[model samples]
Target: MTTLLGCDFSSAPSRRKAIVHAVGHVDRGRVVLQRQDRFESLDDWAAWLADDAHLPWVGGFDLPFGLPRELVEHLGWPTSWVDCIRHYASLSRQDIRDAFAAFCHQRPIGGKFAHRATDGPAGSSPSMKWVNPPVAFMLHAGVPRLLGAGAEFPGLATGDPRRIALEAYPGLLARSVLGATSYKSDEVRRQTADRLIARRTLIHALENGDPPLMRDAGLRLRLTHSQRDALADDASGDSLDAVLCLIQAAWAWQLHERGDEHWGLPAFDPLEGWILGA
Candidate 1:
């Protein structure tokens, strides 16, 4: 059995809002939710990834693994994904914000942010956007740590073959089931009854493999009653998002078992990595 992980990442994590990891493995066609781990700091998360005891695991992380090719070219940065990530790592958050802001300033309204090709299929926020979702900062903070841990990103970069990392977006799964219904919120006030209901509905669909995407992948989520309640009761949705990512990781592993070298990801620009399901 292949160990699997699904991570809900934060560029700047603290005890109040830590990075959440859902750890499990695929059994039969079920993606079982074994446990959840939290990291209050990037250092802690990176250390966890580097730990040999955690070796031979494939993980789906909810962060952009690379920047938009257009943004990289516009900044005259190195076209190589590794070199560009190294360059990105050297800049502080303020530096990144300023640079991305300048890039947006040069473009016209409605086209302010450059996006990766996966953004269209994944329905993700632009990787270069420094605000709102702040995925640019996510890419800034995440890619370097993955590199430092020597995690292998299929078709993008080579590292520890035992530690495979793939880009994942939980929204791709959630939106497929719930459409535009908002299922969770970080703010207490925004955690409405309807959102809670939506979460339950989404979870049901996942467990039963009701969605075409889930059925096609031949994967369903398996959670204990306590686990089910916990995932639904968390108003923040971080735990649930991590589970969604875990499911994606399981789908990738299924493909690998069938000998898909790219782990089901299509041919994509190495400088702008593709999301696992997208």
Candidate 2:
């Protein structure tokens, strides 16, 4: 019995905008969300993840695990994943922005960002982007903590083998559930009826195992009415995103249970790690 988690992360977490974590498990072909909680600080969450009590778990975290290999090579950074992350950690946000901006400036207009192979299928933001979503800051803030926590990343590295971590994107799963349907917003007024409907539809799809990955595995999500409403009504969508990642974690666990090697991850670059389910 392995504990599974999905995390909707914020690079800069606070009481106003906390990180949401969905804790759950797969039981008798159902993915159950045991609870959802918020962490107001990354420090607290990192400590919790590093604790011995949290072992024997797999977590799908909504943050990029690696940057584009092209970007790393172009910047003359170390090619080794660990070393590359170390170099990335050493640089300030401004430094990163300038570097990435320089890279983009040298490239053609249609392709301003250097991308990882998984980006094509995952539709994830470029890990180097320092603004908008500021995922670059996420990589800087999150990956180091993951390394310090010593969690294992399948096909990437082995750390606390009982505690596994994988990169995940809720948008990937959400898009599969509801193509081009808007389901969330941070603005109060933008939390409209249509987005709520989209959330309900997405939740139903998960319950019915509508995604090919869920359907193929004969797994469906189980949630109470209140839980569904909470997921739908949260305009920030952090809670719902966390649950989506939880489902992804369950899928990975299923693959592991069935003795599939690499835990369903494709052969990947050692530096530019692959996203789970990408």
Candidate 3:
């Protein structure tokens, strides 16, 4: 049995909004939810990721693993993914914002941000966007830690064989079930009855493998009553997102078991990583 991880990441984590990780393992066709871990600091999270005890695990992390190739090339940054990420990790957040702002300033309206090829299929925010989701900062903060942990990112970088990291987007999975219906919000004012209902609907779909993607992969979520309640009760959706990622990791692991290297990913640009299911 292989350990599996699903991570809902935050670039800047505080006690109020920390990184959430869903830890589990696949049993038969069921992805069992063992427990959830929260890290209020990046250092704690990084240390946990690097821990050798978690070896031989595959993780689905909700963060962009690479920048848009166009963005990298336009900035005259190193074209190699690993080197480019290293260069990116060295910069302060202010430097990243200024550079990206300048890049957007020269572009026309409705095309302010450069995107990766996976963006269309994955429905993810631009990795360079510093506001709203601030995924750009996510890439800035998250990737370096993964690299430091020596995690292997298929196609992009090679590192520890036992620890495999795949770029995952839970929104891609969630949107399939909800179809633009809002399910979660951080603000207490925004967390309503409808959103709670949506979360329940989503959980039901996962348990039944209702989505075509999940059904096709023969994956179902197995949660105890307490676990189910915990996932649904968290209005922030961080825990649910992590479980979604865990499912993605399980899907990828299934493919790997069947011996398709690159773990179900297509021939995507090495400079810009691909989402697992997308």
- Residue 40, candidate 3: how far off, in angstroms? 0.7
- Candidate ranking under lDDT, highest first, comes to 3, 1, 2
| Candidate 2 Cα deviation (angstroms), residue 52 | 1.1
Give one digit per residue, the lDDT tens place, for model 1 in 34-122.
99999999999999999999879999999998888998999999999999999999989999889889999999999999989999999
Better of 1 and 2 by lDDT: 1
lDDT of each: 0.92, 0.90, 0.94
| Superposed model 3: Cα runs more than 4 Å off | none
- Residue by residue across 1-278, what tens digits does model 2's lDDT show? 68899999998899988989899999999999999979999899898889888668999999999999999999999998988888888888889889999999999998999899999999888998888889989999898888888888777677887889999999999999788888998889998989988988999999999998799889999999899888888887889999999999999889989998687799999999988888
Candidate 1: pairs in clash: none
Single out the weakest 10-residue window by summed lDDT for candidate 1: 210-219
Quality of model 3 by C-alpha lDDT: 0.94
User: What is the Å distance of residue 61 in model 2 from its true position?
Assistant: 0.7
Say which candidate scores most in lDDT: 3
RMSD of each: 0.8, 1.0, 0.7
